[model samples]
Target: MRFLSLIWSNLKRKKLRTSLTILSIVVAFVLFGLLCSLKEAFTAGVNMAGADRLIVRHKISLIMDLPFTYGSRIERIPGVAAAVHWTWFNGIYQNEPKNFFGSFPVEPEPFLSMHPEYVVAEDQKQKWLQTRTGAVVGRTLAQRFEWEIGDRVPLTSPIWPRENEEAWEFDIVGIYDGAKKSTDTSGFFFRYDYFDEARARGEGQVGWYVVRVEDADRVAEVAQKIDDEFANSPYETKTEPEGAFAQGFVQQIGDIATMLVAILSAVFFTILLVAGNTMAQAVRERTEELGVLKAMGFTDGLVLVLVLAESCLIASVGGLIGLGLAWLATAGGSPAPSILPVFYFPVPDMLIGVAIVVALGVVTGIFPALQAMRLQIAVALRRHA
Candidate 1:
């Protein structure tokens, strides 16, 4: 503790160099914090996928439609509890791509039954069931568009355009929220009956089916059975656990986790070299002072600790500041709301960032610290500049 002042003095001797080193550390950790949050945002759906849920889709492609009757057949399969179907609406709101979000046509009762995580009022559920043209938007979507109950929201679909050639208007009868932070609150769901009847083509067709299994452990078995039932048919099916289905979307963009980790690793490695050089230079300049301290009875271990403490102090100060800024940015809101709807600095990730700070300090300081520890007082004094 008494040597802290000496360590502080050594760092202060080269203010600009030390400041630059700290600033570099700040940048590295800021990237670390934001990258962690970004990874979380991209993988939120896969992480929060329902344990007992499985998805049944066309074997060839997701865009291919399956027989709507498959829903009932899937529900009846052994180990399957229930099933609901949703077809992609491919909707644009008010002729703008910025207002784009995932909209789907679905059976209200079965959809609600399958998704216990979507919380809505009982009256809202009833209103959705009764109103044929009614639609339910997620809370995030509602807030984005400032939609309210009974608001008529018109969404235009290029693929499934209405037979009348007008915009497919729907009354927003309900707004649903997620039970957990990771739950998806960006999807807009509407009645499948209206969709089936109004569209020009693909009647009695479904884009995909979400199945709930009776036992979570039996999800794989149920998924296989569901696929086997439709084999050798005109519309072949592929069934997989819901988590894997969500993961497929992420994989399409490439492995975000691995990419982010690789980028972070490269950035840290460069920063390590930069910081290590700065420490070496600073120690080299202070040879005479370190020799004086040793002559005054400073032990080798104390010299090592002082050098390491100086390195750690730089990392700690910069790391805390960088992480604090990252947290504040995430708290304010997502920078790109349309793309990153679920952005936030997770506590566990922040803790990991903290750990990285400590590791960075130790790893960068060790060599310089050892050099200082092994320096003979007479030799160090001779080299003093």
Candidate 2:
């Protein structure tokens, strides 16, 4: 501790230089923290998806429609407990065009039964089931639009446009909160019957089917069986675990997780150069001082420790500042999920931020410390300024 203080005081002797070096480290680490957070956020939905659920989508392409009858066939398969079919409405609010949130046409009763994770009032569920045009909004979506039960919200569809119509209206029957933190809390789910009855065409089609398996461990076998059943059919099926299905959705936006990792690696490498250069410069400027210490009976190990301590101090200061900034950014509210719903930073990401900082401190200090320790007192003293 006492030796560290000496090294710190020496660093303070050139306050501007030390501060600049620390600032460089801080910038690099802040970027590292942000990148790591982004990687976690992009894959967050997959991490949150349950193991017991499986998704059945069009085998050729996810965008292709599947027959609604597949839902009943899937439910009858052994190890399948329940199933619900839904289609992405892809609707907009008013004509603003910028307003975006998920809108899905689902069978209210069976959908709710399959996904009990969405908590809603029992009376609200009954009301939603009874009224064909009734809709349910996620908690986040409700807060964003300031929607309440009984409110008639108008939505304009791009995919299923009404003939020269401005919008379609639906009554909000409930606001649902997710039982789990990972539940997508920003979307609208309404009765498929309402949509089907309103549309003049495309009556018996669905986007995908979500199946709840009897046992989580049997998901793979059941998925294979489901695929095999539809293999020779006109509308073949692609079966995946719920997590993989969610991940496939994320992949459409490009490999965000891989991009973040690459960015983080670059930032860490930049920090390594910045810290290493600072330490190397400090050692060069204090060559005479190190020589004098060696002559005065200070061992090479002690000199190395002193130089390494200086680097550690600089890195620690920067690391803490970066960590503090990261915490503030994440705590304020996640920007990723707001702008891109599929991404969200988790707690493990924060831990990784701290770990990266600690690792940077050690890596940036070791090489310079080694160079300083190997200096020969006699040769160093003989060298001209």
Candidate 3:
């Protein structure tokens, strides 16, 4: 701590150069925070997927429709506790594409039963059940549109236009939240019966079935059994664990998790070189001064500590500022609900950022500090002469 002023003063000698180096570090850490959060958003579904659940979809493609009756057969399978179906509505709000959010039609009771993570009031649940055209939305979705209980929301769908070709209106009966921080709460769900009866075509069809296994340990066994039950049938089934299903959905946009990792690796590698260069140059410029310090009886170890401390200070200051900004950016909520629903910076990742700050400080400073420490008073002075 006594040498802090000396280390700081050395940095102040070339104010602009020091500022630029710090700025580079600031950008690197900022990208670290935001990229990790983005990857989390893409993979949250898979991470929070139910341990005892399986997803049954069409064998060929997700876009292909599956028979809704498959849910009943799936529930009847051994080790299967319950099954529910959800169909994507692709509903648009206020006729605007940007106001897009995930809209699905599902069996109300069974879906709520299957996904216990969606926290909703009991009375609101009852309200949703009683009303034929009732809809429930996540708290995030409700807040985004300023929707209240009993508010009528009109949505149109190009995929399944109503027989009457009129706007499909739903009365908001409930606002649900997530049980976990990573749970998605930006979807709108309504009763499937109304949707089936009202749509022009594709009646008695479902997008997929979520089957809750009676024995979580036997989930894979039951999944295989369910798939075999429909093999060679007109509508073959492909069954997998809930996590794999969610992961498949994410992969449709490309292997984003791997891509994020590769990008971050490249970013950090570049930053490491830039920071190393800055420290190396700083030390070289101060070669004569370092010799003078040694002549004044400053120990080699003390000089090394001082130089390392300076590098760490630069890293710590810029890194902390960048991370703070990233935290604040995510604190409010998802900036784009339509694209990324779950936006949260996990604590583990934040802690990793802190660790990176310390490591960055040490790694960038070590070479320069070592060179400064090995300098001989006479040789360094003569070289500077």
* Model 1 spans > 4 angstroms off: none
lDDT of each: 0.89, 0.81, 0.91
Tell me the spans in candidate 2 whose CA falls farther than 4 Å from its real position: 121-127, 130-132, 148-150, 162-166, 179-181, 291-301, 334-339, 342-344, 374-385
| Regions of candidate 3 where Cα sits further than 4 Å from its true position | 383-385
Please give, for residues 140-236, the per-residue lDDT of candidate 3 as tens digits: 9999999999999999998989989999989999999999999999999999889999999998999999989988999889999999999999999
Strongest candidate by lDDT: 3
Instruction: Judge candidate 1 against the unseen true structure and give its global Cα lDDT, from 0 to 1.
Output: 0.89
Task: Give the per-residue lDDT of model 2 (tens digit) for 47-109.
Answer: 777799999999998779999999889988999998899798887886677776789999887
After the best TM-score superposition of candidate 2, give how far the Cα of residue 380 lies from its true spot, in angstroms.
Answer: 5.8
Candidate 2 TM-score, true structure as reference = 0.86
How many collisions per candidate? 0, 1, 0
- Model 2 root-mean-square deviation: 3.1
lDDT-sorted candidate list, best first: 3, 1, 2
- In order of appearance, the predictions have TM-scores of 0.93, 0.86, 0.95
Clash pairs detected, candidate 1: none
